[model samples]
Target: MRKSFFLVFLFMTLFVRTEAIRIVGSAPDYAGQRLEFFTVADPVSKTPVPFFEVTIDGRGNFTIEKQITQNTYCFADVGVYRGRMVLVPGKDVRITLPPLREKSFEESKNPYFNPVDIWLKVNEGNKKELTNLIARYDARFYQLTDTYFNQLYYRQMKNYLDTVRIRLEREFEKEEEPGYQTHRHLRMKSLEADLLRTGREKVAGSLQQLTPQEWTQPAFSDFLNRLFVNTLSTESKSAAGTRMKMWVARENLAELSKWTQDFTATEGSLSDLILLKMLHDAFYSGEFSSSAILRMVQSPWFSQNKEPRIREMAASVQKKLAFLQTGTPAPEICLPSSTGTIWCSGRNTKPFLYLLFADLEIPVCREQVRYLKTMAEKTGSKVEFLIVLSPSQKVNNTEFMSSNQIPGIMVTDTPNRKTGKEYKVRSYPSAFLLDGQHRVVLAPARTPLDGFEFQYTDLKK
Candidate 1:
């Protein structure tokens, strides 16, 4: 009996924890606080969705263990103090967050006051160098875009872009680390995306010839966005005006597929990118009916392409479409109010669901929240006017609400906010609108104080 028990215990010990990721960290100043880790599911959305969370002990040490199978880009976020990290499968990663000024959080005036200093030591790994390399590449991309996008040397732009690409290649070859080849590709794509986002007409000619492997990169999506938008700018919608619709609206996927087939015949396998691009444009444009788009994405036309990556892109697109679609059920959003009580906003019987994820440290959040208050007053009590305030020492919810004389439901998130992750809020003061069934009508609802006031009016029409 003793021998059998010993053998069973040894077997259990050997097999039980082989696939889990162990994270250990110390943030002395943040004792008794929570630390949340998140990963990006889709680079297009680039919203950090929560994986798991841990609470710091009285001694300022914290440990977290999560069974994560996928290798992904992840970050540790504590409201104003956020630190980025890359999480790989079955790795034990130790992160040490150094102390910050206790009063830094209270300085509401310095909108750019960031206090977190991240020091990561991944056991038996080289993630630090890899992450730093990615950051450097991003910096180079932003620098090159800002430098070349508006220059008189547009004729020599191709040469400048080539030089940047070559530099990136040389840097990648130097480290040439395994498990990080995808990061390099992602960086290259970012550079390309930013170049296209610059919208210089000449950039279309200068973009490096794309490979099938790169079709899934964020840069590819950006380039596709530009291409799709450029094509839509060609035709006028009415007889009286020369202005064309901002997006090329079609009745169904058949029309979009026809265009894709033509573009592919000329550009070869770029049809795959074109298809993904169209899907992106549809979602980002918010011009099309969700049901129509969902039906098209679910159609076999996306799979008939024969390229596995394109098929995978179609699948990914479908997941997001389902999540943000008109009839799909919304996720639970239970967060704490100023009274330290959790406000489960979507649980109640409100006719409409409105969520405003705000960060008062940023000026835009403040502006939007004030504007939201004005709009919410007009919306009446039937609509759940829930303000999901992300914690900031600079902007205390109780003080701000009282000082501004703002009323209604206010839900404050803990330092490690699950609400932000739940909603996938990337932009400051993001707005979401849901139907009576708590289905997302507008994943990101329009703001009253738009920079281009007439833009929303035009879109609504």
Candidate 2:
């Protein structure tokens, strides 16, 4: 009997209630796609790492079960929709997302639009009072900011900020949820930063008083970046922004190197933080250059800091830059058309290629197609034009081919972005020209309007 009891005790001790997270979610309108789960790969870098992914069934139901050890931000990504949950180990979360078909005001490529939409909904449900106050505060900013040059406008905005801060402090005293408290604190900080950016010196002290913990959160880090940049821009309006432009033109990499060094030395763990944010921004901004990226990694600060995530990101940027240079062999990708036909470079015998990475929502994409049609109509063009789009974007190749009378091949790539990454396609309407041997004649060749027809003829020979 003692031996039997020992066996049972050992089993209980070894397998004692393993902690895990389970999530069930539905997005009825977004069926037949994946619900990708991500975590902050590094807190400082704030990079989303693929943790787990599941396909939403035809019925639009999906589930995720992950063994976790601590509280974490579980970010969900769909085609164009995104959501986040601060999940504790052993908690089961049920998520419902609201669609944000918000009309984009600019030709923007911001990826945060999805996460912000879900975050807005999350605040509305869990912190209704704070949400309502912020709503008023946001709506009133534009209404009042037209008179930003006036001192009276500053007084009114300060009073409104004070009220928001008071309510947040009171809620903080009563609130016990760590996640909600973090959200509230960060939101308050964001408001403070906005005020500070608009020449409000009264709240400057509040901005300078951030704790180390707050400095690490992505939201807070973003605020600091904007504050640093906008504040600097405001100071350099000597010639109404032209002075700043000239200064930037005069000192290119040195400006970036100085910013990295200065911010890194500002506070604890911030050296890595500031540099990482700059690199991350540059990586996603689609304006990345080899020299700019090389200057960042080869900086003295990078050697002194030696952060793993920072080094990794720098290496990736470097590799991507080197890979897409002119004369390098382009990475080949196989994809399927909307008509379920497979298309690939290996099957192509054309002597030249006009490769396009585009989206349906982008106006320039359709414009480029019309230009391609005009070129294709010209005689003796021994080139193959192919348009590749992410499945995340709604595009129908059959409908596209029929509507535009485009002669090129249309293929849908997966949202994994593997193809896009390989092609170094950062934004919509990015074009490339390749020779018959699959070499990169032009990594960012040219748009049709740029007289790519001439380059097309040149590459053909």
Instruction: Give the number of the best model, judged by lDDT.
Output: 1
What range of 10 consecutive residues in model 1 has the weakest lDDT sum? 240-249
Q: Model 1: runs farther than 4 Å from truth?
A: 1-21, 25-33, 54-70, 78-82, 88-92, 96-129, 132-174, 178-255, 261-270, 286-291, 303-461
Looking at model 2, the pairs that clash are 264-271
* Alpha-carbon local distance difference test for all models: 0.59, 0.58
Clashes of 1: 0
TM-scores, in order shown?
A: 0.57, 0.62
Per residue, candidate 1 scores C-alpha lDDT tens digits across 1-461 of 99999999999887655467788877678788776666554434343466788889998888978785444456664545556655656657766664543434344334345546342434433534555555555666667656676541444445566677777677656666543455555455444444443443234333336545434344444554544563422323345213223223443455555555654343334554455555655555555455555666666766666766556666777777687655667787887788878778667687777767788778777777777567656656766767878888766768887777665678887664656756666566677777778887676676556532333234347
Steric overlap count per candidate: 0, 1
TM for candidate 1 is 0.57
lDDT, model 1, position 186: 48
Q: What is the lDDT of candidate 2?
A: 0.58
